[model samples]
Target: MTDYVSTTPGLYPLPDWAKDDLSDLKGHQKHDLISGDESEEITAAYEEAREEVIGVQQDADLDRIVEGQLRWDDMLAHPLAVHDAVETRGIVRYYDNNNFYREPVVQDDLGFSGDVANELEAAAELLEADDDLQAVLPGPYSLADLATDEQYGDEAEFLGAIADFLEGEVDAFPEHETLFLLEPSLVESAPEDGLDERASEAIDQVAGATDADVVVQPYWGALEEKVYAHLLDADIDAVGFDFVAEQDDNLYNIQEYGATDDVSLGLADGQNTLVEDPEAIRDRVEWVYDQLPVAEFETVYLTTNTETFYLPSGKFEAKLEILAEAAALAEVKAA
Candidate 1:
């Protein structure tokens, strides 16, 4: 059997350092020449912010580290890396102008214009630099939901292609204990009609493509039994449930699901300023542990639902401190 492994809940809450770095680039016009085709100031700021976020995570004794998503802006700009891989396009629509930095949506059918192998390689390098790090990527479901569907006619086809593309990318990662987290933020918005079926198929395609332990993580709302049931049947390594948003129901669902495959306990609030009480989180974890073997419980991870809800850099830092303290307390209790 694999050794027991534990990781912090994904997204430890943004630190103030992150927010400050973001603010510096907030008003800068995209594609504008701030410094010879790229804004050196923005680049430096992001690098600094990423380091700060990573530092905080390390200090917290987190078993896995995220590159602080400082490269989020850069990643968005390169959507074509993942987008073009699947054929279809039109202007990609933003879920909300508030969440994303870019305004233009793809106006035609999406197609891969360049090789993303380099991008994936760079990301892997960053993750590998940290001994305890895992790479997170946007799942195909969310990509389909976010893409402009004007030219694609059907989102299902686009999603399937994207899944194939993702599988290829996952296979490219260097061998390590690193886990790849597939965050499908749009799963919550899946239509009640036949959309759930399409989403499930797309998820399966991606799950089947990767060798690393995969976690199909959805946040912001409760996962309907119809949707989650499919994940339970998929070959995924684990399913991450956002308990912070829908605690009671999600917790119960996890208890039922935890009996089978691994489950991630999303107790940390990834989007809010409210500092979580470590004791309370531990109690909840304990409640779940009571229902499963200690080895099974090791599959559980503590994390936030998403990372888009941070206030600013300073506040983000404070939040990380809080999370670390709470997690430390929980570790003590667990030991």
Candidate 2:
């Protein structure tokens, strides 16, 4: 049976109480807090919000749960931006989305800051002993692409440095059974001049540093054939394609390029406000199964194409319900 996983790529919208708690600091601000000191109310809110998300996941009977990255200051770039060797610059648009992130400027040699590991640790503490928790981070190539490289003059060198830094970060993190490396930039700005080998090398190094099963998820849209084919050569366990954005293209890519060791079917639309029908989602999953050469891959993951952080809290919950229902229906039909 395919695993139904929740991928929290970035900041999940804070619940009302959590929003109210952080009102004193800055509510829905585009930038990170100048001071890292979080109030008691905000701290409690984070804990409460986590418990609620976990409860929802448990009720939905999801195979795996994500940390729901409620504290991401600048989306995927926050962790890298806050490093001692990096500095935050002017606000910049986050890809094609309405969301924005402070541009990360690499001031010197990159290093593991342990900020992400600490954040993951807090989330890990909240999980039950039996819970299969997944930790997420921005992929090295994507992070290198996002940041302004003032230190490393060469693009490949910069990517290597960032990958090594992430390798250390992954090593520091608590033993996560699964780790997701979000690689949106690879698809968003498909490097046409053949950076494939370098990207694959960087991804392999970072993925090899951890004992956990690593999945590299490229959201936003479908990757070009050359890029997608090269990505499969990476050392990660699975690759997640954005079916919500370009379902036909993604499905075709899988048919043409062939399957990876495993695949993540992103059936849920993350950015849409309208809730998808459970039956419709189930039908889509069935269609995907028909198209895919299932025996070629080890496993499949049913999940959102991107982060659920784009949706309102209510709609996000509804999407989860949809996923849970669809998953259950798929199982019954298979049986």
Candidate 3:
């Protein structure tokens, strides 16, 4: 099996060049650039920024680098490449004004758009060119969470369509050992009444669609086994557990679920500036290693739970430095 390590959770800060372009666009109040005809100046700026990030990864000696998610706004924007990927009319309120939610729109019959497919192909090419890096695509459950309610009538149908779309995208990128990191951020907000059943059904529908190894990541809190039992049974390759949130300690129950599959130890805090102690993180990894073989340790990817911290560029870079340091320490200790 191929081994991997994430630079950190969320995105790396946009390099100076990218920032300059963004500032220029903002100065002109050009919010529509991302969707409209590509500006030569803007495209050049994006390339310089991307090259700088890729160069940083090479310099760091990091084995697997992320495209740094410089392209997509966030996981929600992943499917935006598709024509009318979402319906603007029916929107769901997110946790706060900063985060709004929408559902994915599926036509009367299941259909995939060439625009989305082409965009994904282009994204794959961008990541593939950088031989040192691997790519991560948003998982189906998270995509469903962001879609508008009017899109699917029922969540299952919406999620199933997402699954089918993702399956094709994964197939399209056949050469790379890509990790389809499923971010189920909305699972935490399920109505108190039937949260478990709803979460399970969503996970099952999406997990069932992909052939590539899937990693189910529940970022905000501990994942109740009952809620993720379908993922476990669906033969998911790994489960990413966040250890930074309020109830992170609850992840200890993961041991009871079984250590046979990959367990991504999400120890780095993506939201805070507090640098994590490498020794402390190593201790956590060691605990898991004790239960599983060192060879299996490669399956333990370290990352943050969410990417909310990425909006402001400066903070993002600080987090990246911390992650690089922590990853280095983990490698030394593991060695």
TM-score of each: 0.75, 0.92, 0.76
The number of the candidate with the highest lDDT is 2
Decreasing lDDT order of the candidates: 2, 1, 3
lDDT by residue (tens digit), candidate 1, 147-180:
5444446666666765665566656655534454
Displacement of residue 295 (Cα, Å) in model 2 is 3.3
**1 against 2, candidate with superior TM-score:** 2
Per-residue CA lDDT of model 3 for 1-335, tens digit only, reads 42436544434567756766777765654223244245777656666676666666655555465556554433354454333444333344444445433333444444554433344344445553545334466656666566544555766666666667666655555343435465655345542335445545555555555454556666777656555544466556777767667343444455555543566766767666665665666676665556543355436666665653344655555455555566667666656
Q: 87-185, model 2: which lDDT tens digit per residue?
A: 888998989888888888998998768877877787788777778778788888788888999998988889899999999998999878888898998
lDDT of each: 0.55, 0.78, 0.54
User: Candidate 1: which stretches are off by over 4 Å?
Assistant: 1-27, 30-41, 74-98, 101-130, 175-187, 191-194, 255-260, 289-296, 321-335
lDDT measured at residue 132 in model 1 versus the true structure, 0 to 100? 60
**Against the correct fold, how does model 1 do in TM-score?**
0.75
Candidate numbers sorted by TM-score from highest down: 2, 3, 1
What overall lDDT, based on C-alpha atoms, would model 3 receive against the true structure? Answer: 0.54
Best by TM-score: 2
How many clashes in candidate 3? Answer: 6
